[model samples]
Every structure is written in structure tokens, then in C-alpha cells.
Target: MGSAAPAFYGRRVPLFFNPLEAAAHRLSIAPPMFDYFNTLGLHALVAAARLRVFDALRERPSTADGLATTLTIDPRTAEVLLRVLAGLGYLRVKGGRYRLTRTSRTWFTTDSPTSLVAGLEFWERTACVIWPRLAEAVRDGSPVTPFYELLESDAALSRSFQAWTAALARRQAPATARIIPVPRDGGHVLDVGGSHGLFSVELLHRHPGLRATVLDLPQALEAAADHPRLTLRAGSFLDDDLGEGYDVALLFNIVHGLDDQEVAKLFARVAAALNPGGAIVIGDQFRDSLMPGRASRTLLDLLDLNYRVATGGRVRDFREVARMLRAAGFDRPRHRRPLRSVVTELAVAVVKSPSRP
Candidate 1:
């Protein structure tokens, strides 16, 4: 009947059925389900990082049972975790032994120079906890827990935040120092909202003639290392008087947390704090300058969401930033060469002389 309906595999098939089309349909339908489970891989990776699995593997390759014995984890659990990590390309497995891949060795090992363990820890501990409340943030148009308020309530979390941020800052500071133009002549540098002060320290190292003053919360500054060329000022960037006549001012990774008015006010304060010929270097991730890739765009969007949830702030577009800087009575701003990092592009803007009459 009807030419046997193109029977295949001893079953009748629809006359219009196409194998390619069926395969495409299957793929289209599978991604959402696949994506849901894919996220679990990220969580597992973060957990393994926290548990120092990579660190243990860094010492030497070991069978899952051996690793379990060394780390005091269940053997079956360790094997499963190791298998997952191997599947993810962070580890290599052969002869029932696992070892860190070059990628993991470079980034996951605690002792590696470019290790990202601290930054990853920050994501696991802080951002991961907050992300579950994203729906509430979307509904309320803000994060369920304000970032600063959360820090205020939890001393341990606050310390962890500082440590992770400091670690991340240290990783990027060298590249940032290379890109930004520091005046050759010795001049005072003001770091507004410079929590860890690593940027200032790196800059001071680059320019021995310069001295830096870091203004941030007392808790954030408590862990800052003492330096002959560095001074730590404890207070709010919003209410505190940023002392005047500094040759250069830094507003690094600070603008995204503030609303437009606060950002404008901050620029005004920075303008007031600088010497007539001084420059204010604003270092942040400008939305317009993000790297050209789908991954980068996705990351930028996530960061925008993160800011929106945590502080009712957003990643500023370059045009908006320049407009704000102009409104704050600074001359036209110039963008320096951008430094691309794992998280965001380190964008630097140098404002011409302050317009204070």
C-alpha cells in the first residue's frame, strides 16, 4: 500500500521524512537540555578547584584511587570527578592515572605564576551564590543582596572578596601599567576606590618617582601591604573629600557599581582632586570596547547583569563615559590602548586638564 511507505528498518517511514532534516531537528531540540547539564560541569570544575584537585595532580599523575587516598575523598567520587575533568580537557588520563593538562597547570595550580585559582574562588564563593537569585534581581530590578551590604554583614566573605580581587588585580596590573601613560616627572597619584591597592603598587614600581594614595573602605584596605611610596586612605569615595592637587587620579574598576549621577559626581570629584595639568585615568570595561567574539559579548552581558543585580549599576558604554566625563568639567577624553583580560578589557581614558576656573 502506497509503495510500502518507504519501509526502513522493518518499519514504515513517512514519505516526506529526510534523515538530514531529522538529525537537524534532533540537534535543535537537544541543546537546551544539554545546556542545563553542561552548567553542572562548571560547578564541578569550580568545586574541584576549591578542593585543590588540580594542585594535587600538579605534584604528579595518580590513579583515581591513589588520588582519593591522598586527598581523603571517596575513590568513586574522585574517579568520576577526574573523568569529568578529563572530558573537559583540564586533565589527561591514561593507564588509569590522571594529570593536569598544560592549560590546567598554567591556570589551576596554586603555585603557577599566572594561576587563576583566587579569581575562580571569587566566582565560586561570591558570584555563584548571588547568581541563584538572578530571577529576584530581574523581578525587582536589582540584586536580592546588595554587594556592599553583603560584605558588611559577612566579615569572612568580605575578606575573601578582597583577597580574590587583589589576586586578579595583581595579574592585570602589569599589563595596565604598560598601556597607561604615567608622567615621567614625579607626581602624586590618587587611586579612588582602590580596594586592594595592587594597581597603585604596580604603577609605583614602574615609576619610582610617583607616590600613590589609595582611598577605599577601611575593611578593603586592611590587607594592603605597606609600601614606602603608597598611602592608604580609609573612607567612602562618595562622601569623603578626595584631597586636591594630585597629578594623576585612578578610578579603576570602580565606575560600574555607581549610577549615572554617582559616576558623574565621582568624575567631578576626581577633577577637583587633580592638578591643573593632571590627568584622571579611568580604567574599566567599557561596553563598546569589548573583544570581538561571541564569547566576549556573552561575558560582557553577564558582567552587565552582575552589576545590575548587585548594585543597580551597569557596564558603561564609551559614549556614556565620555559624556559623563565632559559633564564633570573635564576636557575631551582620549582612550589609550586597551588591555584585554580574561574577564574584561582594561580600558583607560585620560581626561584633558580639569575645567575648574
Candidate 2:
């Protein structure tokens, strides 16, 4: 009787053959669902960060109830989130307690020098909202919400954006300083669109004789660190008059946000700002230069899409940049020696003569 056949809609079916169970088995054996549900993971991570769950774990390993009491969340929900994070490798469970993993301890903790909390906050606040409009941007041939316009409208978001970029810049500046040469005779260095001024600061440290001026929007300068050798000028690099007689100039991570004409104009401006034989370094992710099947290439490709949706910017290859530099009256552009930590390639050009206005 236990192995008897069952009737399903007037048809005899084997008792062991359950349609729902078979369907579930098929779905489980299909390709992993993680890829399809990646957004869920990202949102969970963002929520955990915002709730300071990692910070709580940093103090001591705790069970879900302990976390709930500490963070003022429901125990069941806390348990679910902790379990998800543990699966994501940011946390681990041992002895009935959830603890931050090494990766989370270093990056999620507020006190850590390399902490990414600010960056994550900015992403959660701004980028997450903007990314959903990528399709609209593609359809309209421009960003639905312009990056600068978004920053200008929201003061709090603007500050977070600055801090977020500054954190990344601080990490990259040391490697950037190593690749680019600074003038030995205490020449002026102009940093165009230098939001946080960390790159200028790093260069100043490497070349003690160098004095640098950072030119960017006033709001962007709010988070920049002050140094005796560094002067912060608050204005748009495109609209503002860049003071002349600079020996070296940097345009790090900026060109992708401009059109071809704008890049040429920017190069012309840099050329004019430089003294004869002064060097101009353009640092950006050149799509053509990236190797195939590499993680950096994929990262840059996504970043290129981001710029397209956010700023009407298109990431160009090194050849395209070189063409623009030449049109602006600079000498042939050459790739600077690669730095380990700097994924963006550096292209250098020199002013032999003043660029025609």
C-alpha cells in the first residue's frame, strides 16, 4: 500500500514520482543561480555596511542575538544577514558566533588605514541609483542624470563622492609618483581636475622641491588634505584660467568624461599652461591598451560603460589620445613606464612650442 500508484487528474502516477520535487531537483541541478542573483548579494553587502555590522563584529565575535541587541536589529533578520555574509566570505561562523573575515576586518573596519567604508557609502548612496538608468542613457545618447549636475545639486552626496574618490587616489598616488618624473629644480606642478589632491601630495613628497596647485570645483576641494607645498584653487579646470609656467601637469582619470573636442581643448589648455619642454601626463583607462581576457580589461570595460551612462564620456584607446594630443600641438605621446598598482595607463607629451589658441 505504501508503494501504491496515485491518481493525478484521472491519470495513474507512481507514488514516488512527485512533479514538484522533480521540478525542484531539475532547477537545483541547472547552472548555479548565483550569477542571476548577484544583485541580491550586492544589496545585502551594502545594507550590512550601512548597518555597521562588520564594525560590530570587529569588536568581538557574536551570535545573531548578540548582534541584534548590539545593532538594534531583529534577531532572525540579523541571523539571515550574517549567514549571507558568511557565505559571501566577508564573515565566518565559529562556535555559534559570527566574526569578520580577514578581508572584512581590513577593509570594512573604520579604523583601518585602507578602509573602504566611505567608498562603499558613496556607492550605496549615488552610484547604485545612477546605474539603473544606463539603458535610458544609451537610448538617449547621453546620461539621464549628468554626474556633475548630480554632485552640484546634492551637497552631502558631493562630499561623499569626494571622500570616496580620495580614498582610491590615496592608494594609487604612491604608485603614480613612482612612474612619473617630477622636475628637479622646484618647478610648479599643475593638477587639473585634482579633486582630493592626494596625487599632488604624493608627488610633492617624492620631489620635495616641487610646489603644486590643484584645480577643481570648490565642492570637490572640501575633502582635500592640506600641505604647505600644495595650493587648492576652487574652480572648473575647463572654465578657470590655469596659471602658467608649470613644469609638469597631471590629468589623472579625467579624459574619459569628455568628448574628443573637449579632450583636445584640454590638451591645448595644458600645453598653454606649460613652459617650453614641460611635460603633460594623461592618466586614464585606455581600452585598446588593455590585454584580452584580463580582469583589468573587464573592469575598465564596465567603467567605460559607467562613464557613458553618467557623463556622456567614452573611454578612448591610447592612439585616440595621442591623436588629440598632436592636434593640440604637443609632441608625440609616449606611454610612461607601467606601475604595479596603477591600472590606468599614463601617456606623456611635451610642449615644444606654445599651442595656438
- Per-residue lDDT for 197-268 in model 1, tens only? 888888898898999999988777878867899999988888888888788788887889888888878888
Candidate 1's error at 117, in angstroms? 3.0
- RMSD in order of candidates: 8.4, 9.7
TM-score of each prediction? 0.86, 0.86
**Cα displacement (Å) at residue 227, model 2:** 0.5
After superposition of all CA atoms, the RMSD between model 1 and the true structure is 8.4
Looking at candidate 1, what is the lDDT of residue 207?
92
* Segments in model 1 whose C-alpha atoms lie over 4 Å from true places: 1-27, 119-121, 339-357
Model 2 stretches astray by more than 4 angstroms? 1-36, 126-128, 291-295
- For residues 249-309, could you state the per-residue lDDT of candidate 2 as single tens digits? 9998899988777787888988998998898988887877785644456567778888888
